[model samples]
Structure formats: C-alpha cells, structure tokens
Target: MNFWQSFIGGVLPYIAVATLVLGLGYKVTCWLKAPVNLHWELFPYPQTLGGQLSELLSEVFTLRSLFHHNRRLWFPSLVMHWGIYAVVFWLFFLLVGAPVAIYLGTAGGVLALTGSCLLFLFRLFVPGLRQISTPVEYLNLLFIFLLALAALASGALSDLAFRSYFISLFAFKPHLPLPGSYLVFLLLLWLFMIYIPFTRMAHFAVKYFTYHKVKWGEVE
Candidate 1:
C-alpha cells in the first residue's frame, strides 16, 4: 500500500505499453500516407506499379538482402531484429488476444529476454562491427535486459511490481506506485521505440533499400 507497492504494482506500465502501441501506429500511418512520391531514381529498372508493390513486399518483408548481403553480418542482425519483431507481435497478441494476464506477460517477457540476449552477445563477439554499435544501441539492449530482470524479479522476490501496475493502468485507476529505477528504464525504452523509425534503427527499412536499390539495383 506504499509508493512502490502502488506504482510498480499499479497502472504505470499498462499506460506505457498502450501509449507505445497507439503512438507507433499513428506515426507509421502518417509516414505511409504522406508519400511514396519521391523517387530514388538511382537505378534503371522500370516496372509497372504492380511490380513495384510485389518487389517491395518481397524484399522488405522477406528481408532478402538482409539475408543475402553476408550471413555473418545479416544473420545475427536478423536474429536480433526478428526477436524484437516477435516481441512486438507477441505484444499485439496480448493487446487483442485476451485480457492481460500474468501468463502472457511472463511468456512475452521471456521471449524478449532471449532475443535481446542474442543480440547483446552478437555485438560482443563480432569485431569491427562494434564500431557501428552506439551508446543508443547498448542502452537499448540494456533496457530490455533490465525489463526482463524486473519481470523475473517481480515474479519471484518482488511479486506484482510490473503486473499490478499494468492492471491498474488498464483499469483507469487514479492512484498507484511506480519503482524509480523501472520508471527511468521504461522511459528510456519508450524513447528507444519512439526513435526507432526515424533513426538508423530503421535499418529494418534500410535493408530493403539495400536489397532493391543497391544489391539488386532494381529501383525504378
């Protein structure tokens, strides 16, 4: 019934997750709506409108060049990316599939932890690649690690720290407690998510450019 008990055990986290989903949805919608008007006419491949869409879907979704470029470079990057991706889908499943509950949260948390650890290890073992790794990158992975740790800690020693907070947020409770360390970590995590599409973090999208424009050189 105290600050940590109420906040970490209350509404803050659900609000955080919901806000993240809604905000990202809005941003991507706006970007997609605004324009495909700009042409990257650097390549000479001409195609019908249908062909462009087909290629875009295949290269972008399938991550063709992200695979073809160099398996060593792309494989680990793909694992890290797809891991985050699976986490996102898992969240979406939680948002829609059922009422929020401990099982979904725990599973999602575990999955996220596994993916992030793989990425962290990838960067650590791969030489030269570290040059491209930035403070933001380390911070991002560390945030995930902490979140996973928090989830496990709460489940074991700290009971209901994150879960109760989420339930409260979703239920529109006015009062709750939040953990200080968690609050900062969540804020940074949200910032990382918000910054994703706008930054090199968008290599997800850029990989498509490499595939279609540079690797295959199929821009029209």
Candidate 2:
C-alpha cells in the first residue's frame, strides 16, 4: 500500500477515534464538574420514567422543540439528523460486512447532502435565519455538504474497493489502490470525526444532561 493509503486507511482512524473519545470525555467531565447555580423547573415536566423517556425520544427523533418553535427550519434539520443516524448505522454494518451497508451509506449521503444544501440556502437567504447565522455556522454546513457529496461520489465510484478497505482497517490489515474520490471522502470523514467533539455538533453527547439533569432533574 502507498503511504497516503496506509496513513488515511490506518493511522488516521486511530487519531480520529482517539481525538473523538478524549474530546467528548473531557467535555462531559467539565459539564459534570461545573456547579449548578440554579435548578430550573420547566412547567409540566415529565414525572415518570416512561414519560421522561417518551419526551426524550420525541425530542431526539423528531426535533419536536425545533418544529414547534421554528417550523420552517425543521424539515431540513430533521433530514440532516436522520442522515447522520443512517451513516452511523452504515458504519456498524460496514464493519460487520453487511450487504445493506451500501444502501444505508447511499441514502445517508443523499439525505445529508440535500439537507445541508437546503440549510445553507435557508441560512443565506431567509431573513430571520440569516440574522442569527454566523460565519462558523455557514462553514460547518458547507463542510457537511462537501463531505456528503464526496461520500456519495466516492461510493458510486468504488463501492467494493472502499468497503474492503474499511473492513480491512478494522482487521489490522489495510487494503490499497482506493480511488482518488474515496481517498478524499476518507480524509473528510476523518477530519469530521475529529472536529465534531469540539463543535456544537457534539450536543448529542450532552443531551442526557440537558434533558435529564438540567431540564428535568428532580429538585432536592
């Protein structure tokens, strides 16, 4: 295998995984250690475990709060989130050599790319969204859009080769001669894995705290 292939397929996965784990761990630890000055009591909080779980699932899967508050932005946001969900499942299936991995990856790439494009246009053109959107937010959306596009193009160009390469990586034996498009996608994916923990994208990790500990924590 060439140096770029070895590094991208082997060395970078470890770096990305390590960065993600350590960064998320540090962020969660900080959140745990931070003192709570006020115990917020939102009205009509769920009083039962079932009720709490129901609420959490609703908010997570459907982005209910965003739908209620910002209906205009909800569709694309939901699509983007679901795409990320699909891609996560794709990774699991890919590692296990499932035949369904390619479909999941394709669907995820399409949904993510479509959603990011819509979101970018909304943030750029919509008056209210534009007012609140920052340069960093725009950059984030652009990054996701490009990554998704690259994923889709690469998968189309080299479905089998890419799958074999990733699977081999997990087995401690790297494969070689991946298409240039796949290499680009791999690089972007690696960067995204490392970048996520440092950005608001990692809010998923803190949702438990936000929903259970802060939003609905029982008062002593």
Candidate 3:
C-alpha cells in the first residue's frame, strides 16, 4: 500500500471505531440532558424497566429475530453475526490477555469459516435477496468469504498468514508476501459498516423506531 492506502488501511479503521464510540456517547449524553422523554410510548407494550431489560436480553442475546423469522436468510445472518462477534471477542481477548486464542485449535476457525460460507451462500443463492442486492451487499459478502477463507487457509499454512498480512500492513510493509484476501475483506467490511449507517440499510435500525407506529397485524 502507498502512503494514502497505508493511512486508510491502518489509521482509518481505528479512527472510525473511535468516532463511532464518541458519537454514541455524545448522542446518549444529549438525550439524557434533554428535558423531554423521547421514547414515551414503549410502543407495543408499556413495560417496567425490569421487563424491558429482560426483553432486551432475550432479543439481543438469544437473537429473537432469527427464531421469529426462521428462514434461510436468518440462519446464515445469525451465524455470520455470531462469527463476527466471536472474532471481535477473540481480538479483544488477544489485546488484553496473552493471545490465548492462537491455541484455540481448529474449532474456532471451522466455525467462522462455516458461518461465513453460509452467509456467502445466502447472499449468492437466495433469489429474493440476490435480486435486490446491490454492489455494496455483494462486496460485503465477498469480504466475509475472503475472511473465512483466510482463517481456514491460515490453519494449514506455516506463513502466519493472518498476523503477517495485517501486522505487516500496520508496520508500513505492504509488500510482504502475505495473502491480502483477509485484509481486503476486513477493509471492505468496515467500509460497509460505515456506509450502512447512512444508507437505506439503516432500515434495520429504523424499523424498530416505527415498529408500532402502524398496527399492521390488524386491519381497519
């Protein structure tokens, strides 16, 4: 990578993560300081705070969406999401601990690869989804495909492929004999996350906001 690519590949991701964290903090603080209670409805049901907490735990941790939908898309999406979460947790574990995941053997790698492959197939083979998929969607799928591929391949190679590919880029040595399959995938994944917040893909978040605005389950 050149100077700009180095900045983008190395510095931009951290910057984006920082911006996301700080922006979220600022928004929360502003919301707290405001006099108005913005979420008065509690929408579908008026629950006590404890009930809401229990609902949230059930929804997010247990992934209520997948169980509710129980479709091909949901299965792959759930797996890919969990795989990403696992990888992120592992990375944080490495940073704070003694890099214990390196010895996690093939189980972690296999799970990540299978989840990613499922996600890739979901995007590729599902006609209803594929018809509406954009370049960004395809690119995001490609990123996961490569990331999973790299993880699986790295297990068999003696080249320290995952570490060298990223760490080398960080050290300003983009010309290392490292496979860029993972790096490109990661970069594109971050880009997709950044873009999604500003795109129609935000419907994922927006849907919850307006969930009870219209009582669709009942007709007048």
Candidate 4:
C-alpha cells in the first residue's frame, strides 16, 4: 500500500481512537471528581438514582425532551442521532469481520446522510437555530454529512472492500483492497474520530455532566 493509504487506514485509526478515549476519559473523570455546586433548573428533577438513570436512558435513546420543546428540529435530530449509533455499531461489527454488519452499515449510511441533509438545511432556515448557529457547528454537521455520503458511495462502488481492509488490519494481515474507492471515506472516518471530542457530538460525554452533575448533582 502507498504511504497515505497505510497511514490513514492503519496508523490514524489508532491515533483517533486513542485521542477520543483518553480525551473523554479525562473530561468525565474531572466531571465526577470535582466538587459539586448548586444550579437551578425548572423541570423533572430526579429524586433518586433510578430516576436519574431513567432520565439519562431516555435522553440517550430517544432524546425525549427535544420532541416536546423543539419539535421542528426533533425529527432530523433524533433520526441523525440513531443513524450515528447504527453507523458506529456497524463499523464495530465490520472491524470484527461480521458479514451482517455490511448490510446494516449500508442502511445506516443512507439514513445518516438523509438526516444530516435535513439538519444542515434546518440550520440554515430554522430562524431560532440559525441565529445561534456557529460556523464550527456547521462545519461539524458538514463533515458528518460528507462522511455519510462517502460511506454510501464507497459501499456502492467498492462492494465492502473497505470493511475487508479494516478486518484485515485487525486480523494482522493488512492489505489494501482493490478499487481504492473507500480511501476518502476511511480518511473522513478517522477525522471524525479525532474531531468527536471537540464538537457538539461530544455532547454524548458532556450530557452525563449536564444531567447528573451540573443540573442535579447539586442536590446530591
């Protein structure tokens, strides 16, 4: 394989994953270890650990409150959120060399692209959202949309050769598969990993702080 291919497909995945794990690990550890302070909020304060867990689960799986308060953005946001989950799970199974993941991942790529497009558009025309939208926020969404698009194209054009390359890497027999159509997609995937910790996407990690710590931990 060429230098760029070898680096992007092999070396950078490790780097990206390491940064994500360590960065978020440090962030969460700090959140938990730090002293708690009182902050006021208006709704649904959990009185017990179970209540906390239930609320967290709802936000993780369904993002329930967004539906009630921001119905216009809710549809695309929820769809894109699930799409991200499926795509991540699909990628995991691909690395594990699972055949079923190929089909599921392809479907996820399509769903992600669809929702990403809607979110991108909504960011433009949704007046309230548009007012607060930052360039970095749009950049993150654009990158996600591009990554999804790349996955869809590579899967269609190269017959899961990209997955095979990754599986090969994990299997200790790294080889660049033919057609090279997935190279850009793989590159974007690594960039996504690297960028995850710094973006609104890292809300996955930060939500823990928000719900259990800042908003509610003051009571504990």
Computed on alpha carbons, the lDDT of every model, listed in order, comes to 0.55, 0.84, 0.52, 0.78
Q: For model 2, what is the alpha-carbon lDDT of residue 187?
A: 92
What TM-score quantifies how close candidate 1 is to the native fold?
0.53
What TM-score, computed on C-alpha atoms, does each candidate reach?
0.53, 0.91, 0.55, 0.84
Residue by residue across 1-220, what tens digits does model 4's lDDT show?
6788778767887888898998788877877788767665766598988988888898887878899888888888888888888877887776666777777787788778888889889999989889988999788889989999987887732255456666676776666543466778878988888888776677788787788677886676
How would the candidate models be sorted by lDDT, starting from the highest?
2, 4, 1, 3
Off by over 4 Å in 3: 1-10, 18-46, 98-100, 103-112, 128-135, 151-220
The regions of model 1 sitting more than 4 angstroms off are: 9-11, 14-38, 42-61, 95-111, 152-168, 174-220
Give the worst 10-residue stretch by lDDT in candidate 3: 211-220
Output the worst ten-in-a-row residue range by lDDT, candidate 4.
156-165
What clash pairs does model 4 have? none
Candidate 3 local lDDT, 49-97, one digit each (tens): 5664565556555567677775666666666656655666555444444
Displacement of residue 20 (Cα, Å) in model 2 is 0.6
TM-score of 2: 0.91
Error of 4 at 76 (Å): 0.6
> Which of candidates 2 and 3 is the stronger one according to TM-score?
2
In model 4, the Cα lDDT at residue 210 comes to 81
Query: Deviation in angstroms for 41 in model 1?
Result: 2.9
